[model samples]
Target chain A: MTHPKTRAPRVARIAGLVLVLLTAVSGCSSPQKWDLTNITGIMPQLKFTLTDQDGKTLQASDLRGKIPVLYFGYTNCPDICPTTLATLAQALRKLGAEANAVRILFVSVDPARDTTAVLKSYVQAFGPQFIGLRGDQKELRYLTKRYRVTYGLGKADAHGNYEVSHSSAVFVFDRKGDVRLLGRGTDPAKSYTHDLKQLINDN
Target chain B: MQRIHWQKHVSISGTHGRGSMMLALLLSCAVANAAPVPSVVITQARVRLLPGNLPLAGYFTLTNDGSAPVTLTGAISGSFKQIMMHRSFESDGMSKMAPVAKLTIQPRKSVHFRPGSYHLMLMGRQQSLSVGDTVPIQLQFKNSGALTVEFKVVPVGAQ
Candidate 1:
């Protein structure tokens, strides 16, 4: 009787220890809940070839060490583009110096109108971390097709003014150039700040 | 049913505070045809200006206190060379802005012109504007004449 009783207690104690260890292991490996959509594995890695504001060609590998946020818009967009860029600026402001690790890639879909000079001035107004990228129709197609986004240009009016429709999705990639989070222009600045901090801290 | 709608309006007014509650009462009275056509009041008018002569966006709240629905045709401003009413919409992650010909506001209802929705696209600045400066914009309405409202200019990130 004594032997059976002692064995039973020992087994129960062992099971309890195993349970605690299992809980701890789960706590370590569980995925974090991101404020933005956690698209860690849903999309392909970041890849692009576009001209920077300085008219220098750059590739995805060139931005390997920093977090790159890709946004497609034109300089002439009166409301959505500016508002979205300003919101991202606000998020970076919340991050303070940590924002240096972040680079907002404003890719102009309307290269016909957004020349390098126009893009440079337009993006520089947002912040130093912003980089205006322009690509030819072929290069732009390659990049947009890779992400499965679209852009359309409307018929130009008499004054050569036309409407532009582009992807409002904000693609956030980590330092390794792996696409991770997906955000929208309508998202609150706090959401960007929150997810950006996580992406920056993530290994 | 009428009592339920009135209670719902009261609840909505509760969230908007006392001034809105009074407006709600005034709107209810107007809706009952107890008063003449109430003039539309403009509130919280502001313009978001960008740097380097880029276009700007104007946001405001229009309260239609009249019993009849009012149609807002367009807006004009001396500060800008062109003003058009545009609505920003999102579909399948695509952001698109299109011109709106007219907007009809129901009786005793309010229309809010805000970001990601109805806005005044002010382009071609005729005069320079800085933050905190107020610019006058005339809002034209069909069958209701025009009302000049002063819109305070705000920074790009004001929203």
Candidate 2:
């Protein structure tokens, strides 16, 4: 027969296990505060048509139900654009299975060079799920103008090498195509994932 | 090539037997400091072609080490009909791609070749390239001349 005093430790162990299990189900550890949800002031309504990597036409409205993470840049950008997109890739990986719930779109303002094939291979290099889109400059104008994203071609320097400067902001759209958050420069993967998760939870 | 003068302070006329060894030591030290290789060495060069209407893009990095200023005044490769240095920029809701004739680097500075920015445009590919693969790129430098660097292929969502 076990002594009643010995039974006390067993009861305590059970209680601790139950507390941890309950806490996990109750979502206590993941104190997600989505920092970028206040996005009304940044981006506006955006809708346009563009060619995918396979040269097939795809529309923004066609991506209605899923969350969209969009940014504008050209294929020739040397620094900020690439790094920013690369940083997003890190954040996506950190999202793990939740990454499937999101879509990443790289819309090119330099429509002349960022053809369907250019975007296809470019985005394909990043991940199987990544998508690149480009259209005529006129179409780009319509789309970017709505988003309030700033972009322009710089003047030629002494070497005749013209530069293209564009906005570096990454816009997050909720499942309903409404702007939800805006991410700025150079944040760690954990911060991005936390923000993304919080955004998902809120939606 | 300038060979190092390794003669020790010992007088050649009345020096001990160790004079020759001492000269060798001095020469080695001097040679070590001259033209030290950059910390970011571009080896096994590979440049990827850009698809679409735009030219191809190449990925590479500059390592810095010694004190010499290294400048890459564009590059030329044989993988396509033409290979030139290009940079992308955006402004006023417009983005543009143009050729870059030169890229200069000070001592210990690093330059990265990434998407949506400075990249090599491989035009009119002679053959198709596959993902998860790399191609040889002969990097022509204004200072170090030409050195080959290999680029690791990754997906668009690659980190």
Candidate 3:
């Protein structure tokens, strides 16, 4: 039979374990103070099989250990796409060497116009970390639907030019490929830099 | 083109009791002879050139200094085959661009064409353009004559 004094110590030990477990659980549940919209666990993990700028098949696992910042746009887009990419470039510039671990995935919604060659030069202008991806209608639709984002191509004009409308949201995924933050094309560069630094440090 | 020049001296300091009154009177007089003042002044004109022959966005501010409002019908550039005015906006969580047929600037007011706002979409490049190159784009105005403005080509990262 255990002594009463020994039983008391066992009860205390069990209480201590419970306290540590509670702290861990709360830490996971508590909201992180991010300048951008915190989307941790609210969105699915980054999963897509698309054609990279080099015309090679790219799987999500290829970027498993790197944080991916995904944006939907087209090469012909004059305003929003370039602006968004430039904004991300500015943010990454603030990260210094830390920017090496971040990859920007620019998925072209208008795959018809944004060919592999066009997408390659387009993203390379922004930075070395930028990767332009192109997918067919089925692949694009599936990936966009998974993220609850929508993209539409306007009617072609007489010159065979058209407009492509897409979501401006910039999705930042963690190193584990889990979506963590949602930002906009109009957000200041500092906001992205702040969240990216925190995310990089955390993981 | 005839230009309006302000010959009258106007006080700018608020500490003077008659500064506001004098400025108002000067403006009234200036409006009477506003025909000599340029109807539209284009400032901070720049073109953001993307990679390849991708469509570029032109940004500038059109300030109407005349007494009458001026309408910008369109723009044309020898370097680009097609130039269309477009406005970028966010609606329902989507970033969209809509073609703007005509944009009117009120008298003494300014209209800014910048990123994520009113801009000129220049497509189908007829000639190669690089950073620091200047493209002369004529701004077509309704009723008033067109004005040739030089838009400096900037890198994609330029806002």
Instruction: Name the top DockQ candidate.
Output: 3
Instruction: Evaluate candidate 3 and give its CAPRI docking class based on DockQ.
Output: medium
Query: What value of lDDT does candidate 2 attain over all alpha carbons?
Result: 0.66
Instruction: List where candidate 2 sits over 4 angstroms from the true fold.
Output: A1-38, A45-62, A75-86, A110-139, A153-165, A184-191, B1-40, B43-56, B59-70, B86-124, B131-134, B141-144, B150-159
Stretch of 10 with least lDDT, candidate 2 chain B: B1-10
Model 3 reaches an interface RMSD of 0.6
lDDT of 3 by residue, A23-135 (tens): 99999999578999988899999999999999999988899889999999998889988998999999999999999989999999989988999999999999999999999
- Please name the candidate that would achieve the greatest TM-score relative to the true structure: 3
Candidate 3 local Cα displacement, residue B7, angstroms: 18
lDDT of residue A124 for candidate 2: 70
Ranking by DockQ: 3, 1, 2
Chain B superposition TM-score per model: 0.76, 0.64, 0.76
lDDT of 2 at A44: 64
Model 1, A1-203: lDDT tens digits are: 36986899899999999999999999999978888998888889999889999999989999998999999998888889988999999999999999999999999999998888888888888899999999999999999998899999999877577889999999999999999999999899999999999888876
lDDT of 2 by residue, A1-203 (tens): 87999899999999999999998988976654565546754566556788887888888787777678888887765445665676777888888888877788899877776777678767875665578988887777888778777777777656443556677677888777778777753455566677777666666
Clashing residue pairs in all predictions, respectively, total 0, 49, 3
Report the C-alpha lDDT of model 2 over B77-97, residue by residue, as the tens digit.
Answer: 455566778776544434456
DockQ of 3: 0.68
